[model samples]
Target: MTILQVGALPVRKSRGGFEILLISSRETGRWVIPKGWPSKRLSDPDAAAREAKQEAGVTGKISRVPVGSYRYRKKTVEHIRVLTVTCYVLWVKKERKRWREQDQRTRVWFSQEDAVKKVREPGLKILIASLEVRPKS
Candidate 1:
């Protein structure tokens, strides 16, 4: 297993509730949360935040219960099983138009419920369903 991470769950505020940010991968065009490998210098939340900025063009604070793990098949050299990805909820503050200009990225915001259904893997859906949306205190 390569243990490739699926990325972080960046979200935007919606009329009904918080919405999760999603991006289609450059390679597969598959919808996924913004994520990348853990950076040596950045903390997990910071790393996730960076990914959201780079991939989804959104900046926000990500905080929530440590969402559960999820597994998926990745095409990193070949079809490899990704062991797990730690998911988190991010509060989006800004959207950078420059990042969305990338031909590789197709960013969109969905209601958390919609996003939970949009993901391909069952574990990911479970992980999302497990997410505890913090009350805006």
Candidate 2:
């Protein structure tokens, strides 16, 4: 079975306009939106928020609808095509110190254009496009 993961498209407004927060994996150095595997019992949005807190150290409200989906191959999956993820919108409310202190994740903020371009997957690109990104207050 393909693993389903959830992510938060955390956005902030730069002087130029809206921008999304992205992180580079310490393991692979791949730039990706903040996310993690969904645990049983937690609702979808709850999972998104939890991922943001664990991965990015941000607390926020998540969107009701899933933004989009992506598929990737994992090492264990030789014959079965697995590794699917759903992107969700996370509206940042409170940021904690752990994010600034984290050494494993290389975090950066990007303008919508740069963000969309930097994202590795086409499905995630679609999620960024479909991002009903609200203006940061």
Candidate 3:
């Protein structure tokens, strides 16, 4: 069966306008949005919000509905599984001094254009690119 994941494209209003938060993958250290496997107890949007807090040290208002989806191959010990991630927009309200994965990952905030360039996944890149034109309110 295909694996399902939830993710948050965390955005916050900045002096310039808006910025997106990107975190490095623990294994590859590539730029990515905060994401993880779906939680059995939490709704998708809430799960995405939990991931954002754990992975990026930010808290915010999460959209009730996903803004988009992306597919990627994830390699496990024995096999590679296709992961379909549903992405929600998180309008950041607070940033913490530390987070759960702070030591295991690096998090940075970038402009939408730069974030699109930094992320490796093609589908995710397209999603970030779309934000330039249709920014979250």
Candidate 4:
């Protein structure tokens, strides 16, 4: 069975352009967006935002709908599990000095191109590369 997960592509406006936030995974320390299994009580977008706050230490306005989805395989002792992660854009408004997973992971902001290069997931790389941010009206 495929597992469903929610992801947050935390972004912020910068002088050059938009910057994407990425966090190191706890086990592998590889760069990844904030993502986790969905919470039964929270909406998908809200759950994505929650993961962002817990993992990346940022909060912002999150899109109600997912921009895209990606599938990945995760290995466990029993067997390999496939997880489908739906990603939402979060326009980061604030950053916290302390957060829940700060000790377990490191978060950093990277340029769009650089962020694409930092992540190892093919689908996630495509998502980041193809993200089009609209100007505020």
- TM for every model, in the order presented, reads 0.84, 0.83, 0.92, 0.96
TM-score of 1: 0.84
Q: Lowest summed-lDDT stretch of 10 residues in model 3?
A: 128-137
Q: Candidate 2, which ten residues in sequence have the lowest lDDT sum?
A: 72-81
Best lDDT goes to which candidate?
4
**After superposition, which runs of candidate 1 have C-alpha atoms over 4 Å from their true positions?**
1-6, 135-137
RMSD of each: 2.3, 2.6, 1.9, 1.0
Q: Note the Cα lDDT for every prediction shown.
A: 0.73, 0.76, 0.90, 0.94
Per-residue CA lDDT of model 4 for 20-112, tens digit only, reads 999999989999999998998999999999999999999999999899999888888898888999999999999999999999999999999
lDDT per residue as tens, model 1, 38-131: 7778777778778888877888777644466677766666656556677777777788878743567898887778888888889878877776
Clashes of each: 2, 0, 0, 0
Q: Please identify which of the two predictions, 3 or 4, would achieve the higher TM-score against the true structure.
A: 4
TM-score of model 2 (CA atoms): 0.83
Candidate 4 global TM-score: 0.96
Better of 2 and 4 by TM-score: 4
Looking at model 2, the pairs that clash are none
lDDT of 3 by residue, 2-73 (tens): 788999999987766789999999999999999997888999999999999999999989999888999988
**Candidate order by decreasing lDDT:** 4, 3, 2, 1
lDDT of predicted model 2: 0.76
